[model samples]
Target: MTKAPHRRGADRTEAIMRTTLELGQEIGYARLSMEGVAARAGAGKQTIYRRWSSKGALLLDSLLSLHEPALDYPDTGDVVADLRTQIHAAVDLLAGPPFGPLFTALIGEAQYDPRVAAALNERLIAPQAAKTVERLQAARDRGQLSEAFDLDLAMAILSGPLYFQLLITQEPLTHAYVDRVLDALFTGLGPISRAAGR
Candidate 1:
């Protein structure tokens, strides 16, 4: 059966996005080109342009695609432990081959272009990150976490240092580094009984 044009278009856009992401990982955002993604996806350049107005838009969608199955924060009913899992997951992701350059590109590019920044936060960050905040909020409701815990602040604790090391210093993010950050965060956010190191 012939797929509807919109369905076909959707599939092609997805393919292009995937191809663009792979290309970004290989070529870096500065060198990423629609022609490369189109050739890799077996589509024409016009097809890519028709769907995405610019490279930033395409890259934004590519980042958003990582969340299709959705990266949920592990809710182990213990906020500290769950946050540890989330932090480790993020560290592993940032250090992973696929996301390293892609993330570096998106974040760096977003810093320069307001439109890209807005689109990225809207289409990518909000969708997946909101879930992280909600999980922490749930812990707050269950009395597993303190009411004073800040989601944005907590998120900063989790990913900010990693991004800085990766982006600013251009240092490698390793498992040891991941564990260290989580260790410190858990130190502060640990249960009241353990927060005092009982």
Candidate 2:
């Protein structure tokens, strides 16, 4: 059976995005080109351009498509446990391939390209941060956190060590490390400990 026009377009878009990711991983983003992606994806250049104005835009979309479901915060009524589960999952993702290398490359690109930086923050970073903050807010409403708790600072504390491992030290983002970080952050924090009854 013949596919509908929209279906064909969707298929082509998926193919293009997939090709972009593959090329990005194999060749690195600096070497990746629109023409290369088009040739590999078996689509025309205008097809990619029509969908995304630049390579950074295309890559951001591709990573977001793959990274979205992995980063969702789960509410188990235990805030620390939920954060541990989600943060561990996120650390694992950052340690692996495709998402790992591509996301690292995108971050590097963002250092030089303001457009990519803005798009990354606006699209992936901000939304994910907002979701996390919302989860923390819900926990606070449950009396799991202090009313004056800095959710934003809590977020930074949650992510800081992992980013340091990912970018600076180049050490492994181990499960033990995550646990240690969580333990340290929550240690003797009355409200959080009281809520979990730990």
lDDT of each: 0.75, 0.82
Identify the candidate with maximal TM-score: 2
lDDT of 2 by residue, 64-181 (tens): 8755646788898988898888888777766776477777777777887888899889977788789889988998898877777788988888888888888888888788899999
Decoy 2 TM-score against native:
0.83
Regions more than 4 Å wrong, model 1:
39-44, 66-69, 190-198
Candidate 1 per-residue lDDT, tens place, 1-198, comes to 999999987787777888887888787888898888888899988877887777877887787674443357776677666766765666666567667677667778888888888987786567657777787778778876656678778877777778788889988877678778877876676447555545
Q: Candidate 2, clashing residue pairs?
A: none
Give the Å shift of residue 183 in candidate 2. Answer: 1.4
RMSD of 1: 3.5
The worst-scoring run of ten residues by lDDT in candidate 2 lies at: 188-197
**Every model's TM-score:** 0.78, 0.83
Best by lDDT: 2
Residue 7 lDDT, candidate 1, scale 0-100? 98
Worst-scoring 10-residue span by lDDT in model 1: 63-72
